[model samples]
Target: MVSKRGRIDTFVAKRLQIPKKMVRNLIASEQLFIDGHQVLTADTQIDEFSLIECQGNVLQQRQRAYWMLNKPKGVVSATIDNQHVTALDLLAGIDKDLLHIAGRLDLNSTGLLLITNDAKWSQRLMAPKSKVTKRYLVTLANPIDSTYVAAFAQGMWFEYEGITTQPAKLTVLSKHQAMVELKEGKYHQIKRMFGRFQNPVIELHRESVGEIRLDDELGEGEFRALSTAEIHSINVNASV
Candidate 1:
């Protein structure tokens, strides 16, 4: 659920197209049930994902939605942007207002981007203790060397944050390209790390997050609902 902070009376009235007083009556009379429990107060908090029933009629029963986008370069990972096309704009007809980006990519970065209506699920993945790994394919302006690999493994210190980064893995694929795996994401972390060598990142693309890989079949700017297995993978080792 995007938000579970709504009051029951307001939620019920809107869903049933009835007055607030009538919805309150339903709650007072014990006719309203949320997730099979009788509602005792009109002020009881509820969310769109809650299964609400009134006298055997289900009023709202929304399931959480999860999606993965093969993000295209130049698309902002946002719900709304005044100057650029946002990631939500690419969903077309779907009810995107309820969804949010789980892991964000830079405007110029491309590849696997997770979108979901489940906040807890996203929280579990992003939580530092979870240590969920993110893999990125990077193209650099300068030639790569073993020194970069050692520096990354030892973790670099960021002066702005006054903290050392978590150790990251760097696999040199070519003279100018490499694969980077990190357990944490800091603001401009990758770019800043490479900035130590005065090496600008020419290209950056996420290849995967944790156990879910970007689907090869999806073209740029295209997206699809995540599979049941993919959605459950994040919960396998960590508490959600």
Candidate 2:
């Protein structure tokens, strides 16, 4: 619901179809907001144009964003990995419950990854049914050949743990490099699949995921809050 004049927490909750008590709790916790500023009192009212950011997770509202990171090599993606420093370490002050990595990225592989407090955004971006496009740039030890390219584009077989992967895009970007766009992400997939071709991947970088791309200006380990425009783009692209 818009932050209309004369509206309160209870009214907004009812309009959004969320429980009033839950909305009140968010307000009490200083999680409710008016135009990006936190509001502690639920009774605070504003004009319809005021932006509302509920620290409360509203499934139907779909307004929060998880950042897409172009993960760098040597950084573990897990939140807790044998007590070793992981990607979560970079999110210094974020509330644990409001933040989580959207998907997996191997320690050696770097690329576009989603991190967010919004569970629906996470699920929608990572779910197989969503078919969100994921692109990667790979460096190989040996030059790629036409034979490998044909087999990959035609749907090469990938077997791991008890499952075989469906076909994926495998196009050569350069003599010793290739670009792969995949809809499904598997464990050590890019390295494993190309290993069959006798060309081991030396380095990997994820360029983009879905409609979001890693900001080139953001240095490694630096982060910025997601804007409302970026968040809105998620829904706009998902429908297509």
Q: Candidate 2 clashing pairs?
A: 111-206
Angstrom error of the Cα, residue 189, model 2: value is: 1.3
RMSD of each: 2.5, 8.6
lDDT (Cα, tens digit) per residue for candidate 2, span 57-162: 4322323445656567778887677755677777777654445787787888876666776665666767787787788889999988777776766655654466
Candidate 1, residues 67-110, lDDT tens digits: the string is 99999999999998999999999998788757889989999999
- Lowest-scoring 10 consecutive residues by lDDT in candidate 2? 56-65
Top candidate on lDDT is 1
Residue 24, candidate 1: Cα error in Å is: 5.5
Clashing pairs in 1: none
